[model samples]
Target: MSEHGVDSNQIRELGRQALGDAHLQEAYRSSTLRLYTHRLAAVSEVPGFERLRERARELKREVMDHLDFYLAQFAENVERRGGIVHWAESAEEARSIVGEIARRAGASEVVKAKTMVSEEIELNPALEKAGIRPFETDLGEFILQLSGERPAHIVAPAIHMTRHDVSDLFVHNLHSQPTEVPEQLTAIARRALREKFASAGMGLSGANFAVAETGTVVVIENEGNIRFCTTAPRVHVALIGIEKLIPRLADLAVFLRLLGRSGTGQKLTVYTSLLTGPRRPGEDGPEEMHVVLIDNGRIATLADEKMREALYCIRCGACLNTCPVYRKIGGHAYGWVYSGPIGALVTPQLTGIQNARELPFASSLCGACRDVCPVKINIPDLLLHLRSEAQERAPAPTPSGAALGERTTIRLWAWAMKRPWAYSLGSRLARWGQRLLARGGWIRKIPMYPASGWTDGRDLPALARKTFRERWTEIEKQ
Candidate 1:
């Protein structure tokens, strides 16, 4: 339904557009490579990284299995410690809850650290509609806000933009002198955001992990803005997906070790803040703390047998960096907040199978993402499962007539594949038919319907004159 040609239905089109943009391709390639290399080095330095990954995986499984109990326990602890917890069953409910909170606080502006949940609910627009301006305090998020763009990558957010692109944006929007140096650009962002941090009435953030036993919301960041957001404002709001819950405080050690290394290759992120509740007497924290537990399709995802492992994702984005498809065509092509291999598997369930049918098929099934996953999520298997679900759920009829043509074609192919003589005959016919289109070992064009899209960007390799089965029989006779 996206008129912008970036929706799930237009995955091929979005990819083609991204591939044509030289700057975007270069930016994506370099940034992904750098992050990928750093992650490798950092994980290598840690002793028994594989064992640590297995422990993290086990912890995730434990949380998912008893999510309701842990959630109730977490809510009780939070409320007991002078903090409030809000449960949101839907994205609209989440935005309404946050908007009401912001309105009650008489907030004019709020400083927000990078919270993907907030993005999930489109919270900034809700705040704006309620006359509260939400400022993105994280550097990458701030850049995106200034440029009026959504996050292209989950971890980096602005990875698709080059230094020169940022330089132009700052110069045009901030009225700052253009500078292409990364350090100077960062400094400029730091200076601009410091004012927002000091003046904002409330701070908003997302939790990386929320411990059930202790009611602690753990945030890891290198920018120091998350700390500032939590401490500087009179009121603090933390939005977290229900899946972020872990059973015990002690479990933090394994996750903390893996998150930083897997995400950005840091042994530990520069700042790891654990906020329990509102500021105590004579404490330098917010006077009020609010935690919004969002379940917009997450509970549905948890129930899905094929997709439950997706909840184990820590959002480290190691999968994105290692994904060949993501490398070729950055995250915007996915047309959602989350992207990459995890996105393909999780987005369909998070959004809907019908809405995101193309996502599962976008991958090359290279299994690189599964290899790098800290929690060992089998993404390729999940994708294939979703593909079957999508196929099963697809409507059998179009507005004009039956949608049975493609299905019939597939059935005919399957029938032929089961019969040796029919399969051989089909192969021989295909080879002869392809001769007209074949040029220099590739099929430059396919006059056939549906197959026409195959040659839009990449060529299809021509079929051989002899089938492999026939060649094998000939060799045996010889």
Candidate 2:
């Protein structure tokens, strides 16, 4: 596997290990289920919740349509606010831009707030390679950093960690006595991180939204760490994807309203900071502030009429909790910086169709995510789009005959679906087979090439004894 590519099989095994680890699974399950329930309650609080989603959808659509104008406007505003704006066309460019800024600023140790774009570009590894220590200030990130693991969830990075696992880690890494309680474990982490926070020379963050009119970058967080990172450091740098820019300051009202409700079911995030520029002459803040606007495949995405909607995602991770496939396989199985329904669409486009060919087919197409999205990204529609994108290029040559047979079966199904009569005939044949296969009022087994394979693990619900068309035939005879 390539260094950049995710090993899904390995991830699957890891997820299983993590799941069976008992201590971590309960912590993860409890935390995730709580957040999921809260989000539902928060959205329910609003009388016109669905209406707000519709408006937010329109706003995102409008901003994305005139993205060029907003990006230019945002850059200009950054300059006016005593901040330099750097445009990074690729991951390497983003790294080099930040690296250059760090070198010139004489920053040896940098503290990072939660930023997924940085992960996409492998920023921590790059910074380490440059002899600069990049510390993860977010508690979730800090844990994953210690464990040398990738984030398991979008909003909650270390969602996979159990309280007991945390206790073990604190016992090992921070030299604290082992305790399974959440409070003690958190206290240990807090004490250890405070020293790093105080000594950090620079702070790096990712923007949730950039107001083009004000050139203000907004960051929303539950933890106090991001606040400390931005305020304590001599230099502050923000990394944001180009799609993050929204047109007006007023437009923030709609996004902020929906963001928290969708993310954790909180009426509002604990902290919502909107910083337009660096410290003024009288202000006590970072002396130097820079914002890196990263394009990395965003331009290619912008050109895509159908898939551009994927760019509107706010990274709430609601889709992950709701997605049946993601719930089973977890983030690692998607094989990229992203996972879940949104990842199913965005990953293939961000990398290449060839790179994420298997991901589009991973979804159950239940449309649960589409119903929950604050910005109303039509997730199921996008999944279908990705599936088409996947099929455009044939899977590479497989030495294994199993893979070849599977490919042939898929090809045959695709061809048959194109012909209405062939599809109807296949459906009729399937119905006929179900008549015998079904026993005790349900299909317990079906002995056919694919049906047998499917029924091996799952009980097949038998077809209705008579089709609607057949029932209609009896009515006509009567």
Candidate 3:
């Protein structure tokens, strides 16, 4: 179990459940395909999109290389701008830091913009435990909060849900008249959350990017809620992962361009807020601004050269939209906050491979994620690397007498493959053996250990009637 109490080992079972639900499958298929298509269309409009990706990759690499210097500079600049910077080495520390800050401010409630890092650290539950209520201001997040469900996608938290699902949830929780219209649902959530925003003592958010040179925290969103979350309350706190920093303010534009296009097919998100610090004497913003820089295993990822590229992820979730495995299983199956291809890489590393050994193997390794990644992260390569690390660290399986038959079968197959005569004989025999099970040019079931597993989910094409060598020989004679 991870610190979050999520077991990555249960991924297969969770994936199975996800696959069996037709509604869930349709939801994932539609949402991901739409996002994938949008991203392609958006990227095509940019003549140097690949160059942009390469540039983004280079900038992230620079940050990862000199992370310490940039972090210190960012902290100094933030402090200079009157924003307090809190360092948290782990999830518990981060939660504690934020909780303490809330307590000091005498905040009984906090209005939060959509921030994955807060979810990563399980801050909501901690806040509840600390006798504070945290309201999720994002529409999708708000729906999920009402339902007591975890996010199913990084970008679209309630991607697994439908309009009907949201309507039903709103009717049940908000006591609003059920309506499937998108605008109606938005109004229902907004009406409920507006009160929370007005009454909450503090505003909480996660930084999309924090500029080292200018001491700025950048947040982008389509809705205007983030603006309210940062401005409406007396106190505002931003939870940022250590990897969210960029070297300079000038570089923010490059990422903003990539993030919007890659995430939602927009030229730019509707509201891009640059927060430097708390409000000045007559300003209409929070009186106090705090930024919690949480490591929570990012430093460990940084130390490993092979896995460092995972940090370059801007959380745009383009990889998730393009990943086949993620499209099928969805985000929750990976059993952690960050899900999809990037989640598979980040989860095992952040939570330890022993706890999340199955995540590295949960991919088809199709390289779709690699192709769509805004920062040009070679996700397939990194997944393979994590698979190796998981295997290396995995305990050796115990010898079992129940496996004797399988071992003998493998040995015989290996022996037969080494000799032409034996190989030919084996294929001929297999053709004869499959005659009983073969139907409609495919073998639907083999009724055996290994082959049965394959046949359970797939059909095997029946072997050809004539051998290739025999056909070639006949052709030569003709």
Name the best candidate (by lDDT).
3
What would the TM-scores of all predictions be?
Answer: 0.94, 0.89, 0.91
Clashes of each: 0, 2, 0
Q: For model 3, how does the per-residue alpha-carbon lDDT over 1-478 read when each residue is reduced to its tens digit?
A: 5545867767988999999999999999999999889988988999899999999999999999999999999999999999999999999999999999999999999999999999889999999999999999999999999998778888999999989999999899889998999999999898898888889999999999999998899999999899999999999999999999999999997899899999988889999999999998877899999999999999999999999999999999999998889899988898988899988989888888887888988888899889989999999999899887876796324223334464466678899889989999988999999899999889998776667667888999999988898699889988
Error of 1 at 230 (Å): 0.8
TM-score of 3: 0.91
Best by TM-score: 1
Each model's lDDT comes to 0.89, 0.82, 0.90
Greater-lDDT candidate between 1 and 3? 3
Cα RMSDs, all models: 2.7, 3.3, 3.1
Q: Write the per-residue lDDT of candidate 1 for residues 204-274, one digit (tens) a residue.
A: 99999999998999999998999999989988999999999999999999999999999999999999999
Q: Is candidate 1 or candidate 3 better by TM-score?
A: 1
